[model samples]
Target: MRRLACAPDTRPLISDRNHLGALAYCYATREEDCLPYRTARDFYARRVAPELPETVLTAILLVSPGRSLTRRGNVAELPRGKQWFDEGLPERLHHFCTDIAPSLCPTPPTVINTDGATPETVLAQVAGVLADAGLDQTAQRLASATAHAPRPPLDPRFVDTYTQLGGLEAFGHPFTPPIAHRGGTVQLCRLGAPHHDPAGHTRLWNPLGPGPWPPPGPAWSR
Candidate 1:
């Protein structure tokens, strides 16, 4: 037992419920729902955390309320995979942010709210925090740095809407890269979604329009 504890190469065991996922369920509609999560949180702090590394930092991620509710509704409408969601998810998320997550660590946990953001943006915040904690991973930094890079070759309009308008920055950071759909290309960003036609003409798109994102195409069709 002494030799095993002295091992430097040991990796931390990860349990999905070890973190915020448990406290989240604690806010569910019933008292019975709270017990398991409360017990799990207590066990981890008492039994698991001591055996693990003394250094600990918790990073809590939250989605924007608008998107969270939208995705929640979307998931509910799916014909299958209903088990992953519940009507109370929004309330739980809110409670975690306002009530529970703030009091977690002796020092506050780094909380990043992912509202109208690309995966890279959210990941960048996490990587930046970990770097400060003296544990830096090269791949994660590279991923966040290149999040806006065009996957397939970029179209002229996809990069620059007009010569006088400078570049894609005017449309905000790229979310999904320029993807080939039907024949041309489509890309989504914070401000707009743009489409490139087969005829070398590009058209502006409203991503928030009443349809699948990236405008209508065989791939995105309902």
Candidate 2:
């Protein structure tokens, strides 16, 4: 079985496959505002869809409490010819939609109103459902990744760099969160073993500083 890995910073969502050989990508909105279908469709097409693997068979959008999945207009309906699902908490829907029936289900994915749940909570619940459905390996992988997901620093510049370089998996956790140093700010993160530097630290340059500056001290032999 392929181990489910953490979603990269560029995509703030989880992607995994169920035991039935169906692929799913789940996203939880950070804010409480509901997005219209057109906006959602465009965002998915431009930002999410391109990042999805060819194997993906469905897309799920999870939102927080007080939020809804609204149509583009009062009479507008969800765009046709796409396998999209909306739910407050994915685990709840898992029971009813065990089999992948994208082609058969003509109706749009159901819209769920999460009473008041956090993204972390939704992810944990979905992981549990996967475990119950005999996808223990995937469940464990998702749980582990969720637990160690990196928290972005407050600085917008650092956040941008982290997202660009890839999140926890690429840069590991921030050993030293963004902090001011040497007349500028710096963030020290440990890289994944595959890409860790000789010194075992990945130094992110302050976005506020000049461009293309070399490492402060002696450069490691590449």
Candidate 3:
């Protein structure tokens, strides 16, 4: 007898009331029912085809609640072989499904509900939540990104470069704080550097640069 260990399904549960009507249609319908209309291969086609309607594609995005319920006792016993089990795989999958997938949607949903609160207020609330979770750096970055201010706690070397580029006033603002890229950390200023032309947008500042600023022109400008 062979024992098989399967990972738990951590997919979000879909409620009939929560999903759109078109999605609900597919979710409620059984795969066997869909097979009569379309083959399994055709139903799971990646690109839009004459056979696959837009509504069907949208419906495919919804998690099928039935699959979760039906998979309880079914397990495949594989022949003896080296099996690799990663404890962290489930958490990574959860992050991708819950966090990354939503963001990758054509129109990503808003972070918070749109109540009477202003955009600034909502951002502040998010920052506060991050701070409460002991993510001080993330909270600071969120606040800085929203305010369009210089990224706080700048390194000693970049301080002079930031001041020379007219700080927040002339450079517009620090849209992205310094983050590690390629070989060195780079910061993105909303306005281009002084050497670039008028149409130039987004100046790149890297502490590891041969000089203080990135090269002029579109190639190195981004």
List, residue by residue over 1-222, the lDDT tens digit for candidate 3. 001111234222222122222222233233232323234223434332343222221111222223322332223121110010122322333333445434322333223332455557665765664554455675687676654344545444466666664454444445555667787666655443212123332123232334745535222212
For residue 219, what is the lDDT in candidate 3? 20
Candidate 1 TM-score over all chains jointly: 0.47
Question: Which candidate would rank higher by lDDT, 1 or 3?
Answer: 1
lDDT of 1 by residue, 11-38 (tens): 4222223445555655442433235666
Over the full model, what C-alpha lDDT does candidate 3 score relative to the true structure? 0.36
User: lDDT of each prediction vs. the true structure?
Assistant: 0.49, 0.39, 0.36
Residue-by-residue lDDT tens digits, candidate 2, 1-222: 122223324322334333211222222222233333345545555665566453222333344312332331222132110112234433333432433323212222322233476666655666665564455676677666654456644345666555654444444555545676766777666532222133433233222234554324321111
Q: Model 2: C-alpha RMSD to truth? A: 15.7
Model 3 steric clash pairs:
none
Model 3 ranges with Cα > 4 A deviation: 1-115, 118-151, 175-177, 192-222
In order of TM-score, best first, we have 1, 2, 3
1 against 3, candidate with superior TM-score: 1
